[model samples]
Target: MFLAFFLIGLCIFYFYSIKKFVFFSQKSIKHDPPVPIFGNHVQVAFGRRTQTEVFNSLYKRYPSEKIVGYYKGTKPEFLVRDPEIIKHVLNTNFSEFCNRGVRRDPKVEPLMLNMFSEDGSVWKLLRHNLSPAFSGSKLKSMFPIIVSCTNKLVTVAKELALEGKEFDACILCARFTIDLVGASGFGIDMNTINNEQSLFLKLRELMFIKSNWQMFLYGIHDLFPESFIKKIHISRPQVRLIIKQILDSVRSQRTNDTNPRNDFINLLLELGKVGKISGESLETDANGKYKEMEMDFNDDHIIAQLFIFFMAGFETSSTTMSYAMHKLAFHPEIQQEVQREIDKSLAKHNNKLCYESVSEMVLLELIVKECLRLFPPAGYTSRISSNDCVLPDVNVEIKKGTKIIIPIQGIQLDPVYFENPEQFNPKRFLHETLQPRHKYAYIPFGEGPRKCIGARLGTLETMAGLAAVLNKFDIKTSPSSTRNIHPNRAAYLIQFIDGGLPLRLTLREKSSVISNGFP
Candidate 1:
């Protein structure tokens, strides 16, 4: 009797699993065959293949279909290939697909409740309030802080040239960016550029270092439901404590201050004084006028925003500048052209690396844009449907809670839009050359209202760092440098080079180096 009951239970479980796995087939959507329990993301869940590789494979496999169905465990996801559909999801139909579907409890992990992780009304309010903090005037106010960091970077490069030591450009750029963020965002002197044992730098490395268990937890988080994942706390206790202590100290130091310093912390303090952050409502009234909505701005909110600012600002700019320098090392002619442009701009401004001077370097700007196109910091961006909606370009109905991935790397690398996509071509961004391509084809910073909030600040920081390095030294491929970079499979969100970016440096003539008061 016991054996018969066990057999009956097994049959029931198998049938239910089968029913869950056939969701795409029932909807008449084209999808890859899914295995039981693991679904189509077995390799990804196990860390055998990076998300980019999996998306790229699916993108190529279904050439004719605008949308391809796949499963992350039993949950169905849509991989969008068409540019028009991507634009619609990200822009025209944004109201129905605003959330990123990433969830974390604020009480468990206060650092995770930032603008990047939050969705719905909270995201809207925070975005509206923080948007003004990154304006042109505010960025200009912070230029001196960035220039100070770049000067230190140039000094380090000069020392490296004199020593004739080969170093990883990735690490070198990261140190410079960390110092910049410390000074400009938090009003602290990290001094990471000169000190190898900086506390903040060490903590940052520890925070991002992925272990086997952490990866497994991430897999479970992605495959299972949010409620199940919420029950298990994945964040490190020490890291959270350290961050909380630092924030508390900073807040205490500036408790009674009323003056504005134009830094990120100051802006947050001002917002807190207002008690709440307000924004235009996503839902419209009968007359088509949007209503206003607001949310609380407390200590937790402050810490969360500051955390994301530091993470996004430091990582994205450093990677971009490092990749640009690596590419310039291989292409001497292009490097020379960019240097000429930089020289002309500096000469016009009496050798000052100020905002106006860097802004005038058009050739350098094009090079940076091309570098971003080739290797975006965030390879892909995702959105989740809030309600059942039909894709504008393609007549396909997507159900609520369905995941949508916009493959930035695949789209930017497609030969249909870009000629010689494999080659490093800065000329493609010129007015005449760029006129013929689809507007939505290239999205390094993403699109629409949900685009990166710190785009201008990031561009300014990258260009400044690049100009500082190129003005003082000549970058060349070291013995350890590789022509092709392989993306690491371990890093799921941000794509990192498999091996570090190694390069050698040599000092330029004193006459060629701009040494008048600025980097």
Candidate 2:
């Protein structure tokens, strides 16, 4: 009798949930039939594929689709395949699609209320204050920190080169970035470069634990109604407490310092002094004028910002560098091209890396650009309609609160924009040849007013990481390495290699000697 009752309850639940899944069919939009609770994400939820693979597959399968309907569980999501429609959503008609579709209640999970996650007034305020901190001049001031960290990276490469065994590139780059971010953002040497058991490494392990269960819960956040998400706190409490402690400790140190450093910590400290910020909101009144909105930079807000900065700092640059190394390992000719560029730049700067030095290496930049094409760190980006808006190209009206998915990886791989897209061809990014390509088709760092604020800084740091490795050693595919690299299923949005990017390093005969006076 009990078994029969449980089966009856489940049947009722499934039938009730299907009502929300009819959103696409009502609008006559094309979409795959959704299953009970997983919607179209059963494969992903069950760990059969990563989000990148799922979106990329759907995108290619619907070549004629201007906008394909999707479901993140019962939550309706629309996949934007056409470049013109993508432009309208991302840039031209941005305000209408400015909100993140997912509901965020900071009281329940303060850490989720970050620049990357929040929208409307809160996002605008944070972006306005954070924007100046990443300017060229500020990055120039941070160059020494990058140089010092990359030099340590080179030193680590030397030891690995002597050992002559394949090492995990993901872990290796993670260490370098941990040190750089720890020093630049918090004003402390993380010491992760040389020590495997570094506390910061342990801290990161706690911060981003990957599992099928975590991914399921993430989907559930979008799956349920806003009321359900608002009532529950998803971020780990123990993790939140540890991060808060770190934030408090750092504030104290920077506060007591006489000559404060011009770094990320100092930048945030300066913002905190202003108490609050008022900005022209992304949302507008019926008159179409942007309304004004303001927000405070309290301890909760400050700590949340710090968490994103720390997480983004270590994750993005490290993922890019690891993927870049993987490409170089497989394509020696392309690797040789970038190595020559690195050598010329280092020689020009007397074996030292400076901010200006990075700009001069166009070939190296091309390599990084192409690497991002294949393995964009974020893989995809999202937005929601704040008001009813018609897609300019398709003439389809998107209703308020409808989610728009921009598949960055899929667009980058589309043959319409790129020929032989799977081939690792850095020369495709040559300035002379890149003019005619669709601008929106290659958004490793998105497009429009809401694009990543740290694009230049992040790209520069990644270039430096790759430059350091190529400067000291040659990256080659190991005997254990395969041509077909598997994406890590548990890495959430990061395009992590499953077993890590394994590559062998050999000391370069022509490497510029880093003596005592290089810096």
Q: Predict model 1's lDDT versus the native.
A: 0.83
**Residue-wise lDDT of candidate 1 within 1-519, one digit each (tens)?**
999999999788667666788777876777889877668889988988888878877887887888888888777888898998998988888899898877578777787779988988778878887888799998898898888899899888888999999999988998999999988988888889997678777666556655687788888887776647777777556666666676777778788767646788878877887877888867778999887887788877887888788878888888889999999999999998888788788888878788999999888888888888898988888999999988876677888988899888888888888888879988888864546777678988889888999988999999999988887788999999988997776764577666779999997764244554543
Model 2, global lDDT: 0.81
Candidate 2 lDDT, tens digit per residue, 331-356?
88888878888888878887677777
Would you list the C-alpha lDDT of every candidate in the order shown?
A: 0.83, 0.81
Per lDDT, the best of the predicted structures is: 1
Alpha-carbon runs more than 4 Å astray in model 2: 1-7, 19-22, 227-229, 283-291, 431-435, 515-519
Provide the RMSD of all predictions against the true structure, rounded to 1 decimal: 2.5, 2.3
